[model samples]
Target: MAAPEQTPAQYVPIGGDREISDRIEAYLAKRDGVDKLLKISRYASKIIIASSLFESQPLNSKLKSFESSVGVTRKALRLGKFLQSFNALKKSSELKSKRDFMASIASGGEGLYYFVEQFVWLSKAGLIDGKHSSRFSKIGAWCEFVGYVGSISVKWMDLSEIGEEKERLRSESDENVRELKMMELEEKEMMKRLSIVQDWADWLMAFADVRDGKGPLTSPLLLSSAGLLSALISAHKIWVSCKA
Candidate 1:
């Protein structure tokens, strides 16, 4: 007799908006206990959406048929649009002041963490492709966000260092006057970079919290991820300069 055919695992019925809202509430209650709850929440929401999209009979049937029939470029574009909608609120600019900017970047940091957690959940559940999944998108987005933040942090540190060097040069009244002038120029450039960094930082914070129904500005994961990117970039730059 032929071996019995293996059956696909049955999909569990997930609670809809009500369950999602309740989970969000529970997560918020323990927000302070964790370092980057906002970012984590963002990822969690994405995973939930992706899973729901995959499990629902109507949606999954449509998606599977579309995936098989569509070209790779078309599929990628569709995926990008799907992901972009989740963060559409981030493009707003109603709050532009420095204070508001900082608060916003902080929130973005938290959102990064939430997204990471969601990636993990989805991967474990096998709702998406493990090798080419939403996690990769999350990683890319995080790296880009953090890379900008890291650049700013490095510029700030570099400016501080250059400022001290310029002061020391000013105190010296020796034949190194020409060297002092060069140092001054270097300090000016460093300061300019720092200014740009600060402005970018403000923008990033605000971007994370922009939502239609929500208030502007918030994330710890975003902050940490950004910090990590900044550190890596700063280190890489320093290493390259040293090698040169």
Candidate 2:
């Protein structure tokens, strides 16, 4: 059998300085995003191993406490990155033009999809199944939280007033009225998205509450780690029981 040729990833040009691929790369390389995500995945795997040892000697208590701290830190880190990236994308001049904005959106959406896929892989390897692990539950919760925020952000971005004005420019008899209306609608949408982004950013910061050491009764990170560990332990127990 002949080997099939692999297609290269398509790159879209943005402006004179930035290409769509460059922006996507930059976004992924963001310290507040990728670094934290990797750390979270690493810790999540550790939690699974730790959970398995909980039945043994002195390791159980220490692992339990450490798991909580790791979980909180992960949640805080994710929330911070999500807010920063969302705001940057929303405010970019490149995103102001409909065509340019859509390109950026596609880049961002694809990047997030890739991140989530990696997350699922890590979960499976770490034995963080939702049915048996708290860590998996936490991961699922964080996913839902991110989804909610992303949905609202998209809705705000696709404001109808702005869309209508863009359409109006094509056929209106008077150029002056058309231009004025476009400006007004654009400004309104910008202000609305800006306000919503600000509020969401604030909420994420509160969720993390790095300084206070408190936020939700249990941090998402902690719950996720604990869940992952529990799942691994349960699976291990099941295997031992079957062998016995």
* Least well predicted 10-residue stretch by lDDT in candidate 1: 31-40
Best by lDDT: 2
In order, the Cα lDDT scores of the candidates are 0.45, 0.49
Mind giving the per-residue lDDT tens digits that candidate 1 earns over 121-217? Answer: 4553467667755445455356335534644554565566667777777666675785868666685765457455543743364345232113433
Model 1 clashes, total count: 28
Cα lDDT for residue 14, candidate 1: 68
Candidate 1: stretches off by over 4 Å: 1-135, 174-244
Per-model TM-score, in order, reads 0.28, 0.26
